[model samples]
Target chain A: AQSVTQPDIHITVSEGASLELRCNYSYGATPYLFWYVQSPGQGLQLLLKYFSGDTLVQGIKGFEAEFKRSQSSFNLRKPSVHWSDAAEYFCALPSGAGSYQLTFGKGTKLSVIP
Target chain B: EAGVTQFPSHSVIEKGQTVTLRCDPISGHDNLYWYRRVMGKEIKFLLHFVKESKQDESGMPNNRFLAERTGGTYSTLKVQPAELEDSGVYFCASSPLPSGLAGVLSSYEQYFGPGTRLTVT
Candidate 1:
């Protein structure tokens, strides 16, 4: 069985400070990873994704994620946090033989303080 | 160039009542998926449809749930006699199928719609 784990339930950070959201995945083979965010009253937006090649992948909204194969992790990171970045972040991976349906973690709620 | 769209942003129904949710995927996207997030739980996959046919439905909870995509465009999901446990946010997403062409950039990144929040009292 494949699963995604987001250890931090909630994280509070000061605006302009660095931020990191940890994610761990369990899969039999090389996994396709993604990071999504949902702001208050908004739909889920793709932050970044890792399919192959470079371990480091950049995404929209100044977000980036690193895919560490040895650690089975794909953690999201940002150098400077913004107030608008406060939202629920989810770590997800494809579940079935095809990479169409995704299995998401319980999500980490980020709170940015001014 | 509209992204995926869902209808009835929020709905409240009795435990034994029925509710239907709709989703319209992006133009030319052949792969559509349904997912749900219950209170305090991770988002779970419900099913997948490739055009007008269901590709996989292993994630569907029970027979009370029915999903249909007519003419391979818009789709509808109906939960008959909704239960209290069915209260959650239902999400619909779509992505283009792989074209098998080199340099075509066949990415599987799914575009999500604003989920329908269903509350069964």
Candidate 2:
């Protein structure tokens, strides 16, 4: 079965600092990847996704992710962090070929410090 | 436009009790999915429904769980004699069916609801 791994369980970054959350997947082929964010009292919101084409993909809230096929990683990055950006981040991929169900990582909890 | 909505934002019940969670998907969405996240674990898929039909239910944990979507507009998930292990955040999401060729796969975004938090004492 395909699975996603988020190496960081929690991270703290100062406001205005750059941020990057790592995600790795184990699959036979290049699979579609996604990053989702969950605010304190909100539902999961999609940050971005990588299907095919350019390795870099941009998403909502000024977030971007780079898909590195060699590393089996699709890491989420932001040039500068904001206090509002603190939340739990999840990395996900399809359950299987042609399946819409998603398999997610354990997630990384991000905290912003002023 | 309204996003996916779930009823009973939070529920607390004793073991051996029953509880039902409801979800209302976005208007005109054909695909609905259920997922659960146990405390400290990854969110896992529970099932998928395609217009009142169960497309895939391989993720359902066991027989104690029942899900129904009679008219395809709203869905209900019931847990009979809920167990302590059933405590988790249950999420419902919806998306439109692929629009391209029948067999080809197209990427469609899934909009999620605010999730129902279940706690079994």
lDDT of 2 by residue, A1-114 (tens): 899999999999999999999999998888989999999989999899888899999999999999999999999999999999999999999988889999999999999999
Model 1 chain B: lowest-lDDT 10 consecutive positions: B99-108
DockQ of each: 0.77, 0.73
The residue ranges of model 2 lying beyond 4 angstroms of the native Cα positions read B101-107
Per-candidate Cα lDDT values, in order, are 0.92, 0.94
DockQ of 2: 0.73
Say which candidate scores most in lDDT: 2
Clashing pairs in 1: none
* Model 1 lDDT per residue over B1-121, tens place: 9999999999999999999999999999988999999989999899999999999998999999999999999999999989999999999998887777732234468899999999999
lDDT per residue, candidate 1, A5-30, as tens digits?
99999999999999999999999998
The positional error of residue A33 in candidate 1, measured at the CA in angstroms, is: 0.6
lDDT of 2 by residue, B10-117 (tens): 999999999999999999888999999999999999999999999999999999999999898899999998999999999999988877673234335778999999
